[model samples]
Target: MSEKTVIDLSRLRKPDYNGSVQELYFLEEHPEWMVCKTMPGGSVFDVGTIFSIPNSDICRTALRHKIYSLLETPEEWENIYGHICRKYARDKEFLAFLSEGPLEDFRLRGADTHHLGMIDRDTGEVYRKSFPPHPSQYVLVKKYKIIKPSRVSYNDNHLWDYSEYYGADKFVVPLENIVRIGLTSGSSIYRNYLNMNDAERKNYLKELGLREELVPWTLFAKPVVDFTTKYEPEDRSLKLQEALHVSGSSGKKLLDIIKMCILGAILVSEFFRKIGLFLWDLKWEIARDGDKLVFVDTIDTDSIRVTTKANYNNKDYFVNFNKQSMRDYYKIMHSQWFEATKSAKAAALKSGKSFLEHLRAGQAEGYYPGTPQVDRRFIDIQEDKFNTLIAYIYGQATLDSTIEKYNEIGLKEIGYYDANGVLEEYDKLNGMGEETVVRSQ
Candidate 1:
């Protein structure tokens, strides 16, 4: 449905000229496709997306993806082009790298894919900050001329030092605060979801450089760090060229977003620390709109580590607050739960039942085979922890507002893990009703 247009940057550079973007327009014919188009009301611009391609110049592919993400694209494909649609486009520096890296030597590593990312910038509405994966791609010739920019490699990323570990990608990130230490008494290895019977399973474990006595699963290792960041299309340095920009509204907004992000990062970091859990990884990113600060990203699931109290069980295992732990624990449950689920599935098959029917039947029949009193693990643990975290964040808003939401659900506390007295009835604010007044407890 929409027309396709391609502008070749094969010659954006010239030996005689220093070059100027002032004389060029990336989307002159398709101004709407530009990520930062001025809005109709004149108050804001549509901060949109870019397009991408696979097995080509990653920077260029990411650049195109950044553009396409913010605008419209063809909904259906008619051919098997081996193309994948990945959201969260790279930042401007990446495009420059593709445009002007040393043509003969520039290579993109698997880790290079995460230099920077952009999410949901097309609309000026409420945004949901997402974690990474999938990338838009653009195919380019193996041999091409290079037109370099003063800035290249979009991120001053923190590349992981797990060179001896598995996988080519090593968790490269920018603005990451990390403290690496050599393994003294123990070694840690990251896990991949290879089938239990996969041929490489033995090799994968062997690569951890393990000794005969070190039980691999008992090692106290940190969780995988999933990086998150706001996709700022244009850097502040370029915007400063427009005016005495440090005092400019946009510049101030950028500063505000960064400050708020840091505050949030520190807040959670301290909360977990107080619980005797040390978080080795906490990431934050922000996008700006005038004076407003948008908290763009915070790594969830893999973000926190609930370190088991050392020596409590004589097996110091560090529990990462994530889904995998729940799934694995569920799979290994005392065989009773597993058998019940199998029986329920068979009964459903004989009855010609759908998922909902099976679920209701299972629940009515007490298919999970639980005693009235029980010890919880896995899903039960993660659910309570996640719910408490959710409550704490929301509970930070106005006491009256938080109470309003709390009352609607008839929930005094979102869950047992809420430790801050978030919905306690005896609190001064919760005690006051039907009248707005300033009072002391």
Candidate 2:
């Protein structure tokens, strides 16, 4: 079990002065230590004898001792304690206002808890400045007002609940469960995880076969962007082919690559249909866990750029746009495509041209043929299936509308709605694959 640590700022002592003083004096004198230690990268800053507190019981006890040793005067103690009391009083008032007003109306959905820090028992509120792993570092805090009475009351009442401030204390894991903690953010928590001692880290890696090297959690790490910006697509594609050749997987071929590309595009289309926003680009980080190729990293607004309309909108809206549902959709669709195309040599025999031709004929202008010829018939079938799935998820005729527009050019029965308010499956005609089935009036 990992050791636990506690840095009690309230018990700190003042420097130089010698008498019974309150803990607040020591904190006020070393406010920088209290505030800055929690800031991003602030842990590296050591003042005199104080090392930034580590998450361990021994370290916490030592820190507490050092703080007590610093405090020595009653006058200094009273001043600091008085100031702290006033600050707490102000915070309490704000908490009351929060409960009575906007907080009451605040609708929280899909809420997940993160451990900021411990709560002050007397004040009944967690100090925001001290909660983050690094208190001195600042990130932009998104602030908005609410107006629900119940939400306000809940917020106010919940302030007293320390459990609400500090989420589940223990990291509960079953004996045989494979728990992999991927570091995908540059947050302090990630840093702490990365800074674990060699032995501790080795134990963690043993469970998941994850390498110890630290990968930067930046959007720039995306393979697509890296390939497009640093090297020519043809050069990168050639490199990828070379890598595949060296791996000697007989099943992995140019056709498989093309299929993956098509599947990715289809997934993107579906994502746009549901979110009502078009993803400009996406970078997929795939890893094989046993027989499954799972996607890692977040797939949201931060990772990808999205536009509501074909053009940009100037209006500001509070929606996250980066919903988890969209991520799940991408994962599911990608997995399905991977399975479907595993043995698809026929699609590759046509040199990607067949798929392009079919896709072009089925859709009018503006839709680019993603791959060279393969099989237009299979391409049309995939497109229809993709459209149907999108309609089902989004409850909109995104596929139907596009198909209707393209029907004048030749594409027919792209998608249709069912009486159950779901996208209906297409009918297969002449074994050419299914076309969209529209609902009967």
Candidate 3:
């Protein structure tokens, strides 16, 4: 057993950053530590999973730490977490968040209970009997305090948004994001390339004017956007800081971060594979650590998407263990509002406006549909499924006793409603291995 360390965050400072999904703060005692708390906006909007999100978050975070700790050399570990933080160590609080059983059991079982004396940020009292009904929504990870250099800025460039292109915007660089996609059908790149022949695919790449180095990866099962290049034709080179519209700092570059992400993906994918699930894709949030880029935020079921191997050959291939269900619920139950949002977003993009802007305008004009409240029955079903998924993943419950039943319900709903039309379109696109390469374990 490892030695225990105290985690006194009672002197926690106000959040340094207020992100869309989570807030970032540091403790007075452990100044190097970063404390993350999930917020209501972004992904948590529909289902109201503020309290429960941390349960999944801490589990995956600990799992990542476990995988990375297996590295033999200090250099190997440094390549990933060195410049950002020396290590990833879990105290009593981390374990407490994940403990479904009594906290006393963990102490009795020889687990380090040092951080058990941790004071709650809100109440400023140590947990005595057990954790609250739902443990505190916090992601506690040790990280180096990034001292900003006089010449460089870590603001804009550091927040790398690896997402799909809803429109041409300051944040949404379609070409760059397309290159970062994985094999999952949820990616627009995957769906777009699903039906194209090699020649047509080649033409498509040429039409988009993608860099030659990136062309090879566009069709790969996992495309890591590591190639160094200029985003524009006339530019000599694309400096990381300049590309992100920031200044410069001092060890590794963008490619280094991309390599780390790939390594993380492999580690996560292998772990899930062992548990009879395939890790599909991930939404990475990396920040500049002085001179290095390190992954921040959580890596739970919320950030990563996974599917069962049983659906590998079926139309429901990319059906995942995430908020896709909530999305499907909207598509089926509130089709008008869903269609209206899509149309309004498209129009907004055409006029060089954002979806948010369109939403505001549409509401004022009585044209945009308001997001209807989700039925209480649907929300209950989803919460039950989420709990069962966590329980199933952690070995607290058997598969058939939990997620399997929910999976059946989910499949039936999605299939019957033809939610998102992914299944039918996939079938029409010629099923598995027809036009594109369907790589699987």
Tens-digit lDDT track of model 2 for 1-441:
023323454453443222111111223332322211211001100101111112221222222222222122233334333443454464665334223321122122111112122334333233332333222111111111111111122422311111221122122110110111122222222344477887866654443234444342221111121111111111111233343332222233222322322233223434354434434344332222222222222122223323221111222111112221222222232333323222232332333223324334433443332222223342343244334323433335665564343332122212211122222121111011111111100
Best by TM-score: 3
**TM-score versus the correct structure, for each prediction:** 0.24, 0.20, 0.57
| Best-fitting candidate, scored by lDDT | 3
Mind giving the per-residue lDDT tens digits that candidate 1 earns over 318-385? 33343223323323333465455556545554543433355446667775653122223323444444
Over 90-172, each residue of candidate 3 has an lDDT whose tens digit, in order, gives: 33442232232222222233221112222244554443323322334454554543322122225322222222212212121
Runs in model 3 deviating more than 4 A are 1-18, 26-31, 39-135, 142-182, 191-223, 226-252, 309-318, 343-354, 398-441
The lDDT, on a scale of 0 to 1, for candidate 2 is 0.26
Q: TM-score order of candidates, best first?
A: 3, 1, 2
lDDT scores for all predictions? 0.28, 0.26, 0.43
lDDT, model 1, position 295: 30
